[model samples]
Target chain A: MSDAVVLGLDVGGSSVKYRLASATPSEGIPEALAQGTVSTPKHDPVAGLAAIARDVTALHRLVAVVVGIPGLVDEASGTVLRSANLPALDGLALGPALSAELEVPVGVINDGRAAAVAEARWGAGSRERDVFTLALGTGIAGSHIVDGRVVDGAHGIAGELGHVVVEPSGARCACGQRGCLETVIGAPALRRAWNRAGGHGSPKDLLSAYEAGDARAARIIERGAAALADAILTLLALVDPGVIVIGGGLASAPHRIVERAAALVAERATFHRVPAIVPAILGKWAGAVGAVSEARELAGCVVGASAG
Target chain B: MSDAVVLGLDVGGSSVKYRLASATPSEGIPEALAQGTVSTPKHDPVAGLAAIARDVTALHRLVAVVVGIPGLVDEASGTVLRSANLPALDGLALGPALSAELEVPVGVINDGRAAAVAEARWGAGSRERDVFTLALGTGIAGSHIVDGRVVDGAHGIAGELGHVVVEPSGARCACGQRGCLETVIGAPALRRAWNRAGGHGSPKDLLSAYEAGDARAARIIERGAAALADAILTLLALVDPGVIVIGGGLASAPHRIVERAAALVAERATFHRVPAIVPAILGKWAGAVGAVSEARELAGCVVGASAG
Candidate 1:
């Protein structure tokens, strides 16, 4: 069973993380299997991913591979529709490319949804039947999971809660919309708010200032918290998940954003059941863990169908 | 088979509608089966529902009964937790009571969700895998359906999109919140807005006046339409349904609210897929139709479990 392990890869803008796990993830993580990371080629992510796959397979007998990419993916066809970070990989058949190079079954998924899958299987959402994970970093993204399965929706883009318009006239978003939740709560938005308030600092510095009781930092943090609370309440009204796992850079900071947002949600959610808000425990390896889970699920389905 | 037909009851504030559907709803409406309505007793809705069930069963055998009510319902426990209009029925075990009297399996659902089930099974949402139905009448309500089944969420109140806050400081909502989607888009809200603009007329009259290019009516309609568009776009970013069915009295009016909403959504949706916004076709019988569908699904689940 140990010899039949699968490889999971999480490809980001600057680096790619990889890990090996047993084909069935629920059993436990494989012992002493070294997790690895390599710098991603800025211009050729597909080739970079194939190299990583080769390096991982050199030491382990890989049965399957799953890659998590930051992009709009057509999972059914294994195509990367659009990736803002890795633009060169746009329109590429990533899964097929990797499978042909590595000679194993391959799967691909959106990175945000991958984080949700990871959380659902091994993090804060593990015990819940329904979970919504919001990743707040340079950009905001989300994933909705029901009964341990991520809802891919009709177009495979169901969990775009970050783009939901919470303010109709606030700020312009990268997606060309105004007042998107991301426009107000994304990390850049928080930094921008702080800078506009006569504070020149990174998001981390801003959080430290907020913790130190800087009035301007508190005001910026309050605005972000309010926007996040509104978005969470909107999600509660729509998705009604059991637990909302907050992940990424901004939420993981010690600024108490999640606590403040939770309080605001409790205050406003009179007719709806307020969900438990907690931090993501899987950390940076969430995407890799979720990719492995997806590979295992795919393998299980194929085996079940063959047996039937 | 006719003797094994099921009965669906939709209990409203002032009346109850009953229909006898075949054990399977996919086969289409039963030919010539009498559908009836009776005035509901002001103080005893359970008794009124029981009487309606008896009346329907008198002509046709009922193997199962499903009731749709306007309130918070615990579907699994067959309890009505709260009802604003039918206060007397609050906290009553309506499903068990009706099942005991009618001698059949019973299922209870919220009326808004019932409308969603009807649309998903036999109306506008029939062809879509993911559908969000928004019922805009006396109050605004919604249901999120994924792969032909309604997502009841963790607390069984997942589709309360009507309560999502659209404006933070706009208007007070009945749910003790300010600026809820219902506060701006419900029929009563539109009426209030119209009346505030120096117009005294029914909702129908307001629509007619808007159609005739009355400036005040247009202003009111524009406000309502914009608020509705914001709510719909919020839903799209969160739920990402393939189609959105607009139902209830306000939606079905001849003033083309759905068309206007669809246009607004198209104008604002840049990155997200704008779902097809259409009016529901089931009309007044939607709740009854949905109740029957739920009963059939419930019956099928029982049979499957027992056989297994």
Candidate 2:
């Protein structure tokens, strides 16, 4: 069954990214035999599966498929309890429905958790026993890989690291919490805070202003950095992961946030052995690769292999 | 071996609280066959083990023993990596040393985690799949019981939840962090904050003062409560335990803290199904009971049983 491979799909609101790889890739996350994206087919799970099936025609022997979506996933029933992005996907028995259509077992996972597992196993973490990955963008997404397994809370998603209140008097979040980490450090929040502080500049210019010792810009950057540091500290208090992988939509400027966060952690940590704070290597492909890895786990019936 | 029993010891700085119980408890942590406390022997791990061995002589058909200490524990080596209270116990191979003296399988665990395990399985958590227990004392102790197992970090302890920064310009923590949860809400810190706010009263008086409409007292109570609510929120974001058990060093007035914390959680939560905020029923016996439970896990070889 050398030609046998599994399909991994990272289902997003706008597009569907797919990875077709061997059930047991020799190296960690080898280049997929087949990969790419297509516009997401919305409205119903069945229509979505048909669109994917039509595009996924020329793949090798497909043994199984695992799909990652942004939501609270009930893996047992193979349904998305909720998805802020793909509301249409919610409450659909996508696993059973997709499995029936694809003629292979299908698995569902949170996209954030999928990325976390990929980074923990093969991306930036180098196969550490535990890892915490954060996707810092318009909103923040978080998940922990504990003992090499992604952990979700009682409600199927241990999500919203950004919801932690940082400033009791700061901007209100859509989640209705005021002064959340998101309000203090989210990319848009950073830009807004800069504007509120009288800096009429672009997001990229704020990075330059901070580097060039602009006092107002410095304070604004510090607030976000401090919030990120506090989040890091909170994660350390709870899970104590061996490594923390940082990635997502926030480009260039976020490196300074990461650097400051590392410094704050070093300055504040007494009992903690600070783990390597590294950038995610998988980048945009994390969710799809993670889906493949999880699929391999399910299909590879060897001593440690799983079948998704 | 219905007659066989296990010795569970909670080794603290000043006392060793113990319980002798059957491996197969008929119910969730029945009253121990024998239970009590003795002054701790200091200066050496051997002497400590000897004292415990001597007191444990009257127990019946001992199959195993497990000890809980306030420190980072290397369970495999049966050693306390470090303990703030019993400094001499640090780095000592207590498990191997005790096993040699008692001729029984011995295990070592962090006292906080031990209590968490007990509370999750046989105490307030009511055997929930996920439980997060916080021992609110001079130092806040915390642990998560996920899928019925106590989780520690890479270095044997996922500790220092109190170290999470809550205030940037607030009091300095002994751990060298500013505005940690401990600085805002630890028993001693609460007393100091109350005193610093010009309240010339005892710890118990602060509770009544807040009840009597004292603004300063209210703020003091609110700060502690808000800090706790943030910690609770952080836990929800990470592990999403089904229940949260609160108990420990802060007594009497702390009920108000719990009440305020619950209110804040309810007000702030948009999607989180607020977990049951309950008091720990096992109280002082949690660590000892947890040790016994862990011992049972070690000796019992059923599907869900573990030898830890």
Candidate 3:
């Protein structure tokens, strides 16, 4: 077994989160030797990733690296197919370029998928074999973990749950679709709905108002919850995961989105086994943790292939 | 290698289809040695299955048997958890009873999942690794095939796509859910919509009228088609299969459900890889063919385990 430490980087819109850990296949994701956040370069993502990698490597003896990008990624060829937030990363050969620069094996994974891997390995989903993790923040995204591995379907776009149109001719979505789950249940959507209902301040305030018996806030939240429940039930019927780990900005709140959705699921689900819907325990660092898990698996595969 | 012939049975609501074939795991499901259908004993499903198994075994040297049940089935223990069509099968230990009588390895699989396995092995999805097959006849049931194996989920209800609520508060479903895909797109639902639109002898008549430019027929068909499109998009976003094979009574039509859903998917899918929507070629015998495939797999597993 390789005892070499590996680096995991999760590049976000505002910052880059990272962790350095020794990849041990048998033990799963271990405690990070060192972890921190860095300001991502606004204009250049590759340079930002490279800088973070260099800084991390300077402090740790890294043998491999995995970078989780918040976009559509072709994991096989290590290409960033499209990154809406990180425009510089669109069509970038992130894996090869980073590997060449860092002189180590580098892997690229979708950030949502990476979070799922992390959850499956060391977080809420650790005890489950099949799990679906949904991140419901600015946008809604998810990953399906089947038999301890995240399923990155034929076109590397498995678990794009947010894009599923819940309402055929409802609100316009950022993805150019009409009434996607994301359009109705994402953080932005919730905020807009709350504001449209004459509620003031942030989502936090809206949650407080809903909890405090504000009728308008209650109606808006219920609508979003119902839409989210519809999406969750759709997933439940399709994948039938043992559990669904809910993460992201909205889910992180106390008794918020996940709780609401869970209630709706119990009230609505029929015949199908209702999955245990729980909050993601890994929080903001889940992407980084999952990136480490992905790196470890990739390194193990490379070693096994070469040895064979 | 045991080259003994196996009998595959698909127990439907009105009829029981049977296929006798020699187990050939290497080349997938081979052409059946003999195949035919029999009227199902409406009073006793177990006796019906036993009669069919006895009839098949009398002619062929059957070493194994697989039965596809059209309801919730616990495949691991071969118990029919719930079969609305065959009430006598509910909570029965079909596998043990059938194995005891037949004196061979017996397997039971969900009919929808069996169709998915058959499609993955011998039909439109033969070349694909990840395939989602939807049987859109009396109901809108589906099965997800990942890496050529049907995913039955942890609770044996992974592909209950029919139960996924598309119109959350629309129509009541037989499964006690409101606005399920089945409530909107099932043959019965389409028939109801067609008849309400002031036309219809059969679903065929409705399809013909819609094709010939009848406004009321077009409206009814379009409503069902839109609901189906919503369900298909939901599946695509969540499972992201390489291809989606549409089968059952409604799918046999030319330029109907599958074509409409495909067009909707093409227009709606954003960032996610749109899967190929094709018609299932195996027709009515899909369940029986898939049952044979399941039996072959089970037999192979038994042989391998014993040998090891």
**TM-score winner among the candidates?**
1
- Grade the docking of candidate 2: medium
The residue pairs in collision within model 2 are A297-A306, A297-A307, A298-A306, A298-A307, A298-A308, A299-A306, A299-A307, B137-B249, B297-B306, B298-B307
Ordered by lDDT, highest first, the candidates read 3, 1, 2
Q: Quote the lDDT for B137 in model 1.
A: 82
Residue by residue across A1-308, what tens digits does model 1's lDDT show? 23566778888898888887766545443332658788987776667777877777676667777889898898887888889889888999988987887777788888878878888767899889899988888888788888778886666667787788777788999989988888887888888888998988888888888888899988877887888888888888888889998888777765477788899889877877988888899888988888877877766655431221
Better of 1 and 3 by lDDT: 3
Task: Give the per-residue lDDT digits (tens) of candidate 3, residues A1-308.
Answer: 43467788999888999998776554655688889999877776666688888887675556778999988898878999998888888999999988887877899988888888888778998888888888877888788887668776777677888887777778998887788988887777878888998898878888999889999988877877777887877777777889988887777778465678789889977776888888899988989998987777776766442231
Top candidate, metric DockQ: 1
Interface RMSD of each: 1.1, 1.9, 1.4
- Kindly list the per-residue Cα lDDT of model 1 for residues B220-266, writing each as its tens digit: 77777777788777777777788888888776776555567678889
The sequence of per-residue lDDT tens digits that candidate 3 reaches over residues B1-308 is 33467788998888989998776555755678889999987776666677788887675556678999988788889999999888888998999888887788889888877887888879999988888888888877787887778777767677777887778678899989888888887888878888887885877888898789899887776777777777777776777789888887777878476677688778866766787888899888989998987777776766442231
Off by over 4 Å in 3: A39-61, A84-87, A167-169, A304-308, B12-16, B37-61, B85-88, B211-213, B304-308
How far is B152's C-alpha from truth in model 3 (Å)? 3.0
Residue A82 of candidate 3: its Cα lDDT?
Answer: 91
lDDT of 3: 0.80
Q: Candidate order by TM-score, highest to lowest?
A: 1, 3, 2
Candidate 1 error regions (>4 Å)? A1-3, A25-34, A39-51, A58-61, A303-308, B1-3, B25-32, B41-55, B58-61, B303-308
TM-score for chain A, candidates 1 onward in order: 0.92, 0.88, 0.91
Residues B111-179 of candidate 2: C-alpha lDDT, one tens digit per residue: 878888888888888658878888887888877777668777776557456777777687888877778
lDDT of 2 by residue, A1-308 (tens): 24667778999989989988877656656468888998887877566765675467454567778889988788777898888888888788888888888777788887878888888888888668878888887888877777667777677557467777777788888787778788877878888878988887665677788888999988877877888887777777777878888888774245677788889888877767789888888888989998988888766643223332
